[model samples]
Target chain A: MLHTLPELVNQRTTLVRRGRFLCVDFRLSVGDVDYDITVNHGRLVGFTSDGGLLRSWRFRIAAPAQTWLAFWQPVPAPGYHDIFALNKSRLARLEGDLYPFMSNLRYFKEVIAIPRDFNFTTEQDLVA
Target chain B: MSASLEPIVGRYLRTTWQQRPVRIYFEEAGNGIPLVCLHTAGCDTSQFRHLMTDPAVTDRFRVIAFDLPWHGKSPPPVGWQDEDYALSTDAYTEIIRTFCRDLELVKPVVMGCSMGGRIVLNLAAHHANEFAALIGLEAADHQTPWYDTEWLNRPDVHGGEVCAGLISGLVAPQSPDEARWETLWQYLQSGPGVFKGDLHFYRADSDYRDRTALIDTAVCPLYLMTGEYDFSCTVEDTTRTGAAIDGAEVVIMGELGHFPMSENPVKFRQYILPVLDEIEKKSAPKS
Candidate 1:
């Protein structure tokens, strides 16, 4: 099963359990910025946010049974040159100066572990 | 029974070490080797909707067209990154390789249009022996100046709008009816940023010239076609682009533009049928 940081500060957070899925909600300091990430059996099944924004990114991680998924918005917009200067001095400065601030932004991970035997009702259930 | 569009469940075929997402669409018929059909950039497998439903194409080859992450039904990669650079190309190439390996597709004929055309070129160049043949229609060459500029990134630029305009112009029932415009508009809305991201990736790419050279040297039979008014890749440019390749065949269809398949289906079929026939003949067992 996958997991996220236990606590998120600078943002209002809520975790609600709906049947077998866990829905984690986040309302960012920036008004109108909110997102809900859904997890099932420790894997990320889907994510929904304002309009088409998060939906686009969510599709990238919704694959492979045991794979881990994470999402975050980079800080200071990483100037245009950073794209071409990844191996140069600009990247070093950006990594040291800006990365830590954005570290707490938001993220998700898919852990590798099968549900206990008790979680299974039958072979058909397991297949389902 | 004939094949239907019901979603088929399958594993994520990792194309590169990075493991990009590749969804495979399967057809029930066909006994010969599978054919990989790569769709244009803006549209997904839907671009080949007509071809997929046609008995001629499907009965002859088990055609498969995958959603490149950030386009069509596929999701965009986590975070915003340049979509046109070598990184994006590498990721896409990996997706194709992985899809073929996981699905056990052997000697598949890789055909693509526009961005899909660029992809087929990359595949043939990097993994020459993986595909049986390569065909590019109005394919964007790497050396083209598409990357060095960002024409679509303007604040007012909306890909959905551009797509709607292009579709309205290309498709018949030629009235500027609101319903048709709205239909195209709705289709464009599903993945706006993804299209923008792909455009960014295209502009950032710097290896088209090198890859084009590699495709020429790979010694694979290459077929290239472009419409009369294809602004993306002119016939002159495409001819010069594939000049280095020993046996690369080139055809320029008249009275057509960027999308000959959509603009002139009859002529498009006339040109492509002979090629398909040739592929089927060669792929047949030797007596």
Candidate 2:
């Protein structure tokens, strides 16, 4: 269900602009795929579905497919609401550099919430 | 719970332990034993808004919730911004003490969540005679190492949104959308850097690991409760904190979050009512 995240990220301009002052790299691991994203001066310069560049990013925020589904809900419940809560409860893992992730925390938070705007009828819509 | 009983709102004017002029916002309802409720860091008196109106609580005891300085309706102390508002253990304890003293609340039962939860331990340790009992909701001896405050204090960062996102994540997934959003709205409305300032005390200054031994339950009973979904202060954390304090009763709330009382009032009341009943029974004189 998380396959369309890259396309969604590219379509959201305001989300990108929110991180304008942030210049760093990060990764998002959903289910089995890893999405490597790079932002320079708050602009998303690169986003790829390839798992090979996993270690190149500063940090990776990873959660299970089910967890991401709940998080991307229009209004998430407790465990899926925030990335930090996920980490605190041991539901999600944040690895590698945490500086960029924390410094530009709001930008990344809003960026991740972009999926709430999408309409999905089934789990396959996110995966396919 | 009743829709009819509303709290009488008032301002508590008192000098902090530091002797700063502070006006604390408070709401109280019902009569009997005083239950002084404290909200989590970055939150306000509204956390106990429902409890204040609940007859099950008010019929047996007087419930009160107050906003700390730099939070909710309470403005920050004088020279707050230039010096940056920081809540130390002494300052936190003193404010609670001063508020109770000024209100002439004799031996009130104190309960708090998160930062407020942690502070109650200090209140028990240092001010045993001041309260009838202590309840720490989501209380723990220390914050998990996963929490980091570095970026939270950054001038360039929009901390209010980030703080809201961080806190809103700890609410139960089964909670009503209205309840969840209402919780989030409070975080969103918090002052700039206020959440982070509170975190400085919550994540850093409020560690009770070395001090829990000071709490003597014989003088005042202590109870600790944590939500199943509270990742920050998990069941394990609260359990360990309970073990540290002698004779402290620990309860793990299922399908709840950090902000139990505010997140789901009806569900939270189920857990709280029993504890309040026990306290009232103990206070009753003679068989």
Candidate 3:
């Protein structure tokens, strides 16, 4: 259905790189709701919405290519939520650091070694 | 009279031209000139089994139905590419050309249903002289944006592939139909991955509308038909499509959806007989 994320509210953002990983900080507000997201590669590692810890996901840098961050959780867990809430000023600062991190992550992956086989595989066969 | 209700299966013709496997089935009695019937996507010539059995139509002319490449009993081409599976009108035109040449049959009245309809329209547009007349049932009209920007955006339980499987279930009859539908579904899922490839092609290809317009301008007379409730190709859509072709005869089967021929055999025969009669009269020898 509507798989794409909604547009970001605040345009100002930043990104920071550490070793083989990059952190993307961005602020997005929809209606009365706002969220501060710190994304690693394509996965959301740390998230705060409305000045509270929304949720954390198990994220690992893929091998070989190491260009992708794989996010996964146990099968029985509830599904991921779309929106989050966060305070205004912290969101602004986080947004500045997050954008550059995402941009740099994309750049490094493009410039350096490519990532391979980043899909999640369950040990238990769901189909069977 | 031709054999009645008895399953008549025989070896007709087989060829491996253009690296594509081809099989042809020839019936005893068909009126007027030879009519080549092309089935829709995913279905074999068996879908036309009822039409083949009807004496009124078969006695008047020779009806030739063949499996399109990689469908039904026809084997896929060696190392077939996904691009080659769902053909453009140009590719279909070539197939008809090759079929006619190999079978040594003159340009006959070409009638097709669904995907078959699309192919015949392409032939009529580009090579009108090769066919006497053309009939299309629920032919695909719009291209890329129509499906991608619109239909593809709609939410479904298992995407378009599963939706197609559901439609097959609806068309199939209950008693013996269950088995047939199951077989078709299995075939669709496992066969050549053509279904997915074709879906993508329909979404990406931009020339479908242009081809419909081209067919409309061709010299040969064109006939368009669709069921009232046909969700795949609606009557309104068919009406708009017919408007593109000058003097194109349009028929809307009331209370009928897609696959009118299969859904209502009696009514399908009633409508088709007159066309066959007219073609027979035209093709008759003059002294």
Model 1 C-alpha lDDT versus the unseen true structure: 0.49
User: How do the predictions measure up, each by TM-score?
Assistant: 0.56, 0.82, 0.57
Put down candidate 1 lDDT per residue, B225-256, tens digits, no spaces: 87655545556767876675567778776655
Tell me which residue pairs clash in candidate 2: A1-A126, A1-A127, A2-A126, A19-A42, A20-A42, A77-B173
Least well predicted 10-residue stretch by lDDT in candidate 3 chain B: B144-153
Say which candidate scores most in lDDT.
Answer: 2
Docking class of 3: incorrect
lDDT agreement with native, every candidate: 0.49, 0.80, 0.50
What candidate 3 gets wrong by more than 4 Å, as runs, is A1-128, B1-7, B10-32, B80-86, B143-164, B169-192, B199-206, B211-218
List, residue by residue over A1-128, the lDDT tens digit for candidate 3. 00111112111132122212444545433223344555554344443445445543222121111101111211111111000001111221122322242223323222211111223343221111
TM-score of chain B of each: 0.77, 0.94, 0.76
- The deviation in Å at residue A94 for candidate 3 is 35
- Select the stronger candidate by DockQ from 1 and 2: 2
Candidate 1's docking class is incorrect
The positional error of residue B48 in candidate 1, measured at the CA in angstroms, is 0.5
lDDT of 2 at A100: 75
TM-score, structure 1 vs. true: 0.56
Error of 1 at A48 (Å): 52
Interface RMSD to the true structure, each candidate: 18.2, 3.4, 18.3
Supply the TM-score for candidate 3: 0.57
> Lowest lDDT 10-mer window, candidate 1 chain A?
A67-76
